[model samples]
Target chain A: MNIVKLGYKNIADRPLSTLLSLLLLTLGVGMIALLLQVNRHIQQQMENNIRGVDMVVGAKGSPLQLILSAVYHIDAPTGNISLHEAEQLRKNRLVAAGIPLSYGDSYKGYRIVGTDHQYPELYKAPVSNGRLWQEPFEVTIGATIAQNLGLQIGDTFMGTHGMGEGSEIHDEHPYQVVGILGYANAVIDQLILTATESVWEVHHHEEEKSENHPGEENHAHEEADEKHSETTAHDGTPGEEREITAMLIRFRSPMAMIQLPRMVNENTNMQAAVPAYEINRLFNLLGVGVDTLSTIALVIMAVSGLSVFISLYNALKDQQYEMALMRTYGATRWQLVWLVLQEGLLLAGLGFLLGILFSRVGLLLISGLMEARYHYSFSGGEIIREEWQLLVASLVIGLLASLLPAVRAFKINISKTLAYD
Target chain B: MLITRSLTFSYDHRATFQFPDISLEAGTDLLILGKSGIGKTTLLHLMAGLLSPGTGHVELMGTELQTLSPAKLDRFRGRHIGLVFQRPHFIRSLSLQENLALVQYLAGKRQDKARSQQVLESLDITHKRYDRPHLLSQGEQQRATIAMAVLNNPQLILADEPTSSLDDTNCLNVASLLKQQAATTGAQLVVITHDHRLKAHFQNSILL
Candidate 1:
C-alpha cells in the first residue's frame, strides 16, 4: 500500500531490464571490492614485516631486491657479503642490532635461514615447544614450516644445495629440528632458522670431500663422519672465509636514519638499503597497476549508471498511463517522482550487497590460489573500512541516475495521459 | 458541494475550452454529456485539480483550488475529491482489495482492510477481492474503480468516461454502481462521458 511497495512492483514489472542494470552494477562494484581487499592485505603484510628492520646491508644490486630478500624472504639475495666486513659496519655506534643471514639452501622450498638468536627476538617469535638451536645442524622450524612439513621436535631432514625444491640434497649433513617457533605474522613464520656456522660447515665439508674423491659414490656417508672434525675452532665467530647473504639492521636512534645508510653505502663494500624507501618505491610501481584496475572498475560503474538511467527513462515512458491513473487516485506528482527514485535506490542497494558478496567469494578463490603458490595467507574475511565510502558512492550513482526520470514523472500531463486511454 | 465559475483551458492556444458553470449539492448525482474530443476528460481533470484552469476557479466544499499552491492543492484534492478514469487503472501489482487500500493510503488515511472488504461486498465483487486488477472482468474492474473512488469518502467523486467502452448491460451496471457508491458515501457524483445511453439515467444532465 506504500509508495515503496508500488516502486518495488514497478521494478518487478520489468525483470529483464532490472537484471541487466543490476548485473552491470554488481560487476563494477565487485571489481572495486576485490581490489580494495587484495591491496589492503598486501600493504598490511608488507608494513608488518618491515616494522623492526630499518636498513638492509647486502651485496650491491637492486635495493628493492635487498628488502624483498632480507625483510620478506621472497626474492633471491643480490650476492654474498664478507661477514668480517659486515661485522665492522655493525659495530658502528649508531647500530642497535645487526642480525646476519646466510641462506644458500632450502628443504622442500622453505629457505633455511642461518642467523643468531637475535633474529627470532626481532620478530618476537618465541619457541612454542622444545628449545632454540644451540649447535650447528640443530635447526628451529617456523610455525608454517612445521605445520606444512609435519616436522616435530625430533624430526631430521637434509638440506638441498640450492634454494628451490629440486636441488641436490646435502645428505652428508642432516638438520635435526630442535624447536618450533610460535605463529608470528612476520618473515620468520616461513623460515628455518639455525646458527650461521651450520651453513659454513655444510658447504665446507661438501667442498673438501668433492675435491678429495671426485665423482665417488657413497662419499657423502663418509663425509658425515668428518663433519665434527671440520668445525672451525672459533665456531660461531664471523671470520675472513665466512660469508652471509645479508644483514638486517635496526638503528639505535633517529640520527642513524640520516648518517648510517650513507656511510655504509659510500665507505663500505656492502650496499645499505633502507627498508622504508625500497618498500615505498615498490608500492609506487605496484600502484600504477592497481590504479589502472580501479579506473577500469570506475568506468564500468559509470556505464552501469547509464544503463540504470536509460532503463528508468524507458520505464517512465511506458508507465505514463499508470502514473496518470495514480495521480487521478490522489497521488501527488512529487509522490510519483519519489516512487521512481525509490526504485533506483532499491536496485542500487541490492546490487551493492550482491557485489560485496561476489567480491568475498572472489577473495576466497584468490586467497586459495595465493596460499598454494606463495605460501602466503590472506584471510579475506576482514572488512575494509573504505567499503562504507564505496557504499555512499554507489548510492550517489543511483540517486544521480534516477534524477531525470523522476523529474519526468513530476512533469507528466495527467489529463493528456488519461485521455489517451 | 461543488461549484465552478467560467473554467477555461488551452494547450498552445490552438483549442481553448471555456467550460460551463455548474453546482451540485452533497449526495446528488450529475451527468456531464459531451462528444469525444469535446474536452470532457479535460473538464474532469480540472475538477479533480489534476489540471489548473487558465481563467477560473473550481471550488469544492468552499476551497478554491486555483488559489491554493500546487502542494496544498494536491493535498486538498487527495483529502476531499475522488476520480475515476475511462479505463480501470489500479496499481496492477496489487489485488482488488489492496488497490482500494492503496487509495485510502494515498489520501493520507489509515488503511482499513475491513472497509475495503465492505466496499467490495457492496459492489458484489468480494469474490474478486484478492485477484489482481487484470484478472477481473470489465464490469468487475469498473466496480473496483468505484470502490477506490469511495474509499476516502470524498466530498466530490468525478468519473471520466467510466462506461465509454462497456456494452448496454455493463454500462448500466457501472453507472448504477457509481451512483450507488456515491449516494451511500454522501458525496456528489459527476460522470463525464460521450455515451448517450447514460442520458436517461441521471435526473441532472449537461450536454456539450
Candidate 2:
C-alpha cells in the first residue's frame, strides 16, 4: 500500500539477486565487526594485565619476552636474575614498588608464581576465602585455577619441576591451598601464588636429595627432619644467593622513565623492558594485520554497494511499466523515487542485521577455539561503539547506490510507458 | 463536472493532436473513442494531469490543473481525480483491500477501512479482499482496479482504454460497472478507448 510495501515486494520478486547482494554485504560487515571485537579484546587484555607495572627487569634476553612472561604470564621467562641484584633495584629511590616473581613450576599447566602479596595487590585481586600464602608450602590459587582444577582450601598438590603440564614431579615437597583469590579478569586469575621461598625450597630440596641420598626413598624419615630445619631457616630471611625470574617495577616519578631503563641496561646485567613501549610496538604489529583485513572488508562492502546499484538499475528497467501504473494511481514523482530508495534501504538494513548476527556467531566459534588453544578467555557478546559507524557507512552506501535508479523512476514517462503497454 | 477547452498536444513538434472540446455533468458517462496513435492515451493523461497539453486548460471541479505547481498539481490530481488504466495494475505486494486503502491514502483522504470494503463489495470482488492482485483472475483484477479508482469518491474519474482488451461480454460488463460505480459515487466518468463496441454504451460520445 505504501512505498515500503512496494519496495519489499520488488525485492522479493528477485530473490537470487537480493541474496547475492545480502551475502556480499554480510561478509563485509561481518569481517569488520570481527576485527573490531578482536582488536578491542586484545587491547583490553594487554592494558588490564599491565595494570600500572611500569617496567620488567629480568636476566638479559628478549625484553618483550620478560614482560610477556613475568607480567602477562603467557610466555617463557627470560632466565633468572640474582635476588641480590633484584633487591638492589628495589632499593632505588626511583622505584615505588617492586614485586619479584620466581616461575619454575606448574600445577596442571597453570603457572605457580612465587611472589609476595604485592602480585595480587597489583592486579587488585583479593582473597575470596582463607588468606594469602604465608609459609613456604602454603599456596593461594587464582580463581580460574581453583575452578578448573577444583582445588578448595586445604587441598594439597605437589608441584611439577617445569612450568608446563608434562614435567618431572617434585614429590619431595607438597603445596597446600591456603586461599582462593576472587576473579580479577586479569593475568592473575590464571596463576597460583606462593612466597618466593617455596620455589627455591622445592628445587633446593631436590638438589640436596640428589647430592646426599641419590634416589633413596627409604630416607623419608631423615628428609622430614631436614625439612623441619629448613623451614625455620626460611622465616624472616632474604635468601640473597637465590634468583628470581623477574622483578615488576613501578617508577616513583616520571624522571625514572628515562633514568631507570637506561641505568639497568647499561650498569647491570639485567634488562629493563618498559611495558608501555613494548605494548605499543605490539599493537603496531597487530594494527597492520587488522588494517589489511579491514581494507579487504571495505572493498567487499563497496562491491556489494555496486551490486545493489546494478540490481536496482536493472530492476528499474523491468519495472518501468509498474512505475507508470503507479503514476496512473496518482503517485507523484517523489513517491516513485522514494519507492526505489526504500528498496535499497530495505536491502541494506536486512544485510546489516544479518551481518551483525553472523559476526556474533563467528565470534562465538572463534572464542571457543581460542580458549581451547591459548587458555585465554574472550567473551563474544560485546557490541562495540565502532559498530555505529559501520551502520552509518552501510546506510550511506545504500542511499548512494539507489540514487540513480530513484532518479530514473522519477523521470519515467508515464504516458509513453502506458501507451506501449 | 469536468471540462476541457482548446486542448492540443504535439510530440516533439512532429505529430500534433487538436482535441475536441468536451464537457460532462456529474453522474454521467462520456466516451472519447479513437483508433491507435490518434493521441487517445495522451488525451487521457492530460485530463489526469499526468501530462500537460501543448495548449489548453483542463478544469476539473473548478480548479485549473496546469496553473498549480507540480507538487500542488499532483496533490490536487490525487484528491479530485481518479484514473483507471486498461491493463489493471496494483502494487502487487498489497492485498485487494490494501490497494483500495492506498488510493484513499495517496489522495490525502482519511483512511476508512469500512469505505474500502464497501467499494470492493459494490464491485462484487469483496471475496478476494485480502488476496494479492496477482492471485486474482483477469476479471477480478479489472474490478479491483475500478475499486481503487472509485475508492476516493472523487468528483471526476478518467479511465484509459478500459475495455480495449476485453471480449463483448466482459467489455459490456466493465462499461456498465464504470457507469454504475460513477452513478453510485455521483462523479462524472470519462472513458477513452479505441474499442468500437463501447460507443453504444455511452450516450455522450466523441470521436478523436
Candidate 3:
C-alpha cells in the first residue's frame, strides 16, 4: 500500500541487476568518501604537527626539509648549525623561546632525538613515568617507542650508526631509558629524546677507536675527547658544545616571525623555515593527485546516474502493459511517474549510506598503518560535516537521473499498449 | 451514463472509422461486435479517456471528457472508469492486493480493504492475493486484474476483448462477474470484442 513498498518490490523483481547497480553506485560514492576523509586527515595532521612551532631555524638547506625535520620527525636535518650561532639568534629581543635539536642516531627504526631539556617543555610533552634524560648515556623513550619495544625506564639499548636497522652499532656507548613520554598525538610520541652530547659522543667514540687510521686517529680522537670532556666538565653538563640538528623558534609577535627568517639567513648560516608556508607548498604539490582522484570519482558517480536512467527506462519499456492496465483500473500517469521516481530516490539514499559506511571502515584500516609507519594520526571513527553534503548531492543526482524516464512513463500510449497486450 | 456524438478516429491518414451518436444509461450491458481492425478498441480507449477522438465529444457522468485537460482527464478516467483488456496486464512487481490498492489511491478513493477482499473472493482468487501477477496462473492473473478494475467502484466499465484468452467455462464466469460488478456499481458496461462467442451474454448489442 505504501509507495516505498512498491519501490522495494520493483527492485526485488530483478534482484541481480539491482544489486549490481547498487554496488556500482556504492563503490563510486565510497571512493569519493574515502578520498574526502583522507584529505581531511592529512590536513589535520599537518596542522597538528605545526601547532606550537612559530618558526624553524636550521643549517641552510631545503626549507621543506628544515620544517620536516624540526616540526615533524621525518626526513634528515638540512645540516647542523653551531651552538654559538644558535645562542646569538636566541639573544634577539623578539625571540621568546628556543629549543635545540641534535639528531644523528636511531634505536631500531625510531629516531633518537638528542636535544636539551627545553625540547620536551617547548612541545608541552610530559613524562608519563620515570624522569627526563639527565645523564649523557640516559634516554627518554616516546610513548609509542616504549609500547612497541617493550622497554621500561631502566632498560638499556644501543643506538645504530645510521637511521635504519642492521647498521653498525656504537657498542661502547649504549644508552639507558630513563623516561617515557605520554601520548601527545604528535611526532614527539614516536621518538627517543636524549641529551645533545650523547649522540655526538657515540659517533666521537667510534671515530677514536677506528683501526683504519692508527696515526692521526689517536691524536684527533684525543683532541676531540679532551675538548668534549672539557666542555662537558666546564659547563657541568654532559654535552653543551655539541652541534644540534635544528632549533624550534618561538617569537613574541607576528612581526618577529617575518623579521627573524631574513636575519637568520643573512646574519648566520642557519636557515629559517616557516612551517605554514612549507606545509602549504607540500599540500599544493599533493593537491593535483587528489583533484584527479576526485574527478575520477565524480565521473563514476555520473556514470552511475546514467545507469539509473537506463535501468528506469528499461523497466518502463518492460512494464508498458502493466502501466496501461493500471491506467484502465484508475491509476493515473502521475502515479506511475511517482513510482519510478521513488525507486531512483531510494537507490540514492541506500547508496549514500553504504558509501559512508565503507569510508569509515576503510579509514580505520588505513589509520593504524599510517600511524605506525609515518607517525601521523587520523581519527578514523569520526564522521565529518562534509559527508552529509556528499550524501545530499548524490541523492539529487539520482532524482535528476530518474526524471526523464518518469516523464516517459507519463507519456506512454495507454490505448496502444492495451491493444498490444 | 455514457454519451458520444459523431465519434471519428484514424490510425493513419489513409483510413478513418466513424461511429454514430450513441448513449447508454447506468446498469446497462452493451456488446460492441466488430471484425478485426474496426476501431472497437479505439472506441473503448476514447470512452476510457485514454485517447482523444479526432472529431467527437464523449460525455461521461455529465462531464465532457474530450474537453477536459490532460491532467483532469487522467483523474476523471481514474475515478469514473474501469477497463479490462483481453490479455491480463498487471504491474508484475506488485502483488495483487497492492495493484488493487494503487487503483484506489489513484482514484483518490477511501481505501476499501474489505471491498478489495470481496472482489478477490468473488473471482475465486483470494488465495492468490499476495502473489505477484507473474506468480499467479493465467486465469488467476486475469481475475486479479478484474478485481483491481472494480476496486474503485467506477461509474463506467470498459472491456476490450476480456474473454479472448478464456475457455468456455472461464469466459462465461468472467462475463457473469463483469455483469455482476457493473450491476452492483450501477455502472454502464461496454464490451468491445471480435469474439462472436460472447454475443449471447448481453441483451443490448451494437454491431459495427
lDDT of each: 0.84, 0.84, 0.80
C-alpha TM-scores of all predictions:
0.90, 0.92, 0.85
TM-score of chain A of each: 0.91, 0.91, 0.88
DockQ of every predicted complex? 0.59, 0.50, 0.54
Q: Write the per-residue lDDT of candidate 3 for residues A1-421, one digit (tens) a residue.
A: 6556777888788777677667768888898999989988888767877876888988787899888877887776666777777878888999988887877567887888888887777657899999999989889988878887899978898987546576556688889998999977678888899987787677666654654577755553343212121111122333355566788888888899778988888878789989998999999999999999989988888888888778877887888877766666566678888888988988888888888888788888888888767766576556678888888888898799889988888888888877775
The sequence of per-residue lDDT tens digits that candidate 2 reaches over residues B7-95 is 99988887789998988787888988888888888899899888899998899888888998876777787777788888888766567
Candidate 1 per-residue lDDT over residues B164-186, each given as its tens digit: 89999999998888888888889
lDDT string for model 2 (A288-393, tens) is: 9989999999999999999999999998888898777766666788998998999998898888888898888888888778665555677646677899888888
Q: Which consecutive 10 residues in model 2 chain A have the weakest lDDT in total?
A: A225-234
Which candidate's TM-score is highest?
2
Point out the worst 10-residue segment of candidate 2 chain B by lDDT. B90-99
- Residue B114 in model 2: shift from native, Å? 1.7
Relative to the real complex, the DockQ score for model 3 comes to 0.54
Candidate 1 has what TM-score? 0.90
Q: Rank the candidates by lDDT, best first.
A: 1, 2, 3
Query: Interface Cα RMSD for all candidates?
Result: 1.6, 2.0, 1.7
Candidate 2: where is the Cα deviation over 4 Å?
A: A208-240, A379-382
* Docking band of candidate 3: medium
Ranking by DockQ: 1, 3, 2
